[model samples]
Target: MRFTLRQLEYFIAAGETGSITHASERINISQPSISTAISQLEQELDTQLFIRHHAQGLSLTPAGRIMLMEAKRLVEQAESLYAAASEASEEVRGQLNVGCLTTLAPMVLPELSISFMSAFPRASIRPHADHQEMLLNGLHRAMIDVAITYDLQIPADIEFTPLVDLPVHAIVGESHPLARHSAVTLSELAELPLILLDLPLSAEYFTALFMKEGLSPNIAFRFSQPDIIRTMVANGYGYSLANVTPRSDTALDGRKVVRVRLSGENRPMTIGFATLKQLKKSRLLAAFATHAKSFISDAYIPGMVAPAMGQKKR
Candidate 1:
């Protein structure tokens, strides 16, 4: 075939992103290279693949849309063939597209990815951080191979392997009245201002905690980013709930934040790897999954405080 797999891959990226610039960033290739690949692919296929917009980027011609689907299937099959070869040789080597919850990515992925790469020098990982729903969508669409995330609203089509249970904790400024308490109840927290980490399904999970207890939080602020919420809590804006507590009892701005265990019956979120049920694990994916299982647990969660002893998994 005149068109190479690399060309097809570029076409897929461009078709998905709708922008050569975005596709280049997605695949870590130069804009010129992607542009050249797409142009060449269209030439080889003897058809116009995309309608070029002056500045708005490219839109797939109906033909481009059709090719994208086939290209993805071809690429997946190629990857599986390579994975089988690697498995036969007992060599874990390939690019793994890994997704993680945005909240967990900073604390978990860097260390886990670095160590995993160090252990298997032949392997490389590309990390994508997004909300739970987006991550799941990525898994279904084959945009990501696996996701490191919580067992929150997990759909049946995805399989989650539990590694650790992270119990929720209330974080507050050092001077906050409830900060000195050994543990605080949902009722007590409901009375105070709550700085909510408001991200898609994550927001639902946090709010559900309050709903389960028949109490509504006195939400003072809503922020999508966790660090901002931590900072807001540290500066005494309001207390916030979290599963993964930072090892340092301070926010990015160096303000002290205290993690007090949530008192009474509350569900702890299980951290684990999620993959599509139907997708066979590639050798690189399997190796990474094994590494993740070994690396993350109750005793040790990279860049975060270990789960408190005697914290029962729900």
Candidate 2:
């Protein structure tokens, strides 16, 4: 039936409150209007949804259960539409949605977000954290205006810009033998049980480091979450290689995990900004992108990096 969604809302409120008077009060409508709406809805559906009892409220029939579910869904959808409209923007003063890969968000976003707000005080930032593919899909669907992710598997619809290059370090428990060394050979890391990051590029880069020296890593485990892997390493589970050097005491916990130079292998995840190729960027988005790149270069990348690899950071 093509009845108005308002009818469903009224029915749901009446069903929930069990009183036409209460439903009218809740929806700010007159009791007579509420009763008429309910009657019209029941007539349209050709079902007795509520059984009216003398000197008491109403109760639902079995058919009412099905209608109630649909009514709730309609109400929810209506509320969502209302919210979307209320939160809509007329200029750069609207909502700015952004997505970033997990690895980059932890390091880059806190600083960049603050800078973006300073630049565009009117816009609100919504950030999503996901893998590279999800971030790209978000950009393509206009769910996100920008993303910060590893420079790998870029889509043609997205324009990639290098934010900075962070050096990949060999992280180990402070007590590990290599932790004392300023520089370590790949042959030294080969004998250790590797707790690897699940990124294919990372896996290949580390594996190649050992293979070039004709030694194999005793890989112990693979973990997707950096925090989980960091904890495992702190507990002396196994060694891992990563570019992110968490500078604060909170991240490393007073150097329980020591980050050292990866001497023989130079592998870094080139962090960067990306956006949709076809869509016109908002001033807010352009401002955020510029802020993000500058923030990374100042805070994370130690030296001036070579022009970033657009699709690969190997």
Candidate 3:
């Protein structure tokens, strides 16, 4: 190959950190050396990988984005090949780039990270979280090796492995009249002001529940973050709908909320991992997936109660 692995590493560092200076600091290399590698890479590829921003940093162009994906896949494959050859008798170890749905980050990512790293000390894990679209984009770009998110709208290029089923529930403050009920239905719940989660595709899922019942939700507040939605519901601003329940009813602000099961024929969302359909699962990725499936079960998700005796799976 005309370009060396060292050049690809330098380019990846600069692309991730968005700055030649920061990339140099991160890898303990000189800024000029990093710049030279990137320049040489661009010359060989005949494409501008980054658009320089004065005093700010660099931004990856469309071509840069495509190249970044292939670069990551190549580097990961190379690392896996070396590990397999050198540690044939040893434990699986290498780098992992994992992502989670933004809503699931606060609820589950920390526990999964701590558990995985504790078991595989030699393996490096980088965890990231964003909305559904960005997470899918990351997967498609090979920036994230695997993701744990609800089955909202997965593209055809991605493959999802369902691990847990989380049904929608109504969130309300202790003082709300519906708080006394064990479960609430959409017809009755829709009469009250709704504090919408308002994330991409997520908003549609929540609202569609009421739409199926021929009812319209009276939306009082809309927020993209789940914690904010909980805080709003805890403070009695309005009732909200959620899938992942934190262990505590109290929000980060210390206001308490209650989770009431939703009644009716609404479909539950499947929580699972997403990866490129064609990508071969490295030992590191397989090991992580095994841990993740066990970490997420019907019995132990925070803020979520155990599934019903005859609960269905999708």
Q: List the residue pairs that clash in candidate 3.
A: 245-303, 246-303, 247-303
Q: Which stretches of candidate 3 lie over 4 Å from their true place?
A: 1-90, 302-314
Q: What is the lDDT of candidate 1?
A: 0.89
Cα lDDT listed for each candidate = 0.89, 0.71, 0.85
Tell me, by lDDT, which candidate is best. 1
- lDDT agreement of model 3 with the native: 0.85
Worst 10 residues of 2 by lDDT: 302-311
Least well predicted 10-residue stretch by lDDT in candidate 1:
305-314
Error (Å) of candidate 3 at residue 222 is 1.3
- Candidates ranked by lDDT, best first? 1, 3, 2
Give lDDT tens digits, candidate 2, residues 1-314: 65778788688878978988878875667888778888998889889999997769888888988899888777656644543554464334545667877765775566566667777676667666777777888788765778887777787777999866666678878777887888776777877888988764556766766777788888999988888788788778888887766544233344477776777546566778888889766555665676676666534432222334211333
At residue 210, candidate 1 shows an lDDT of 93
User: What are the models' TM-scores?
Assistant: 0.85, 0.64, 0.77
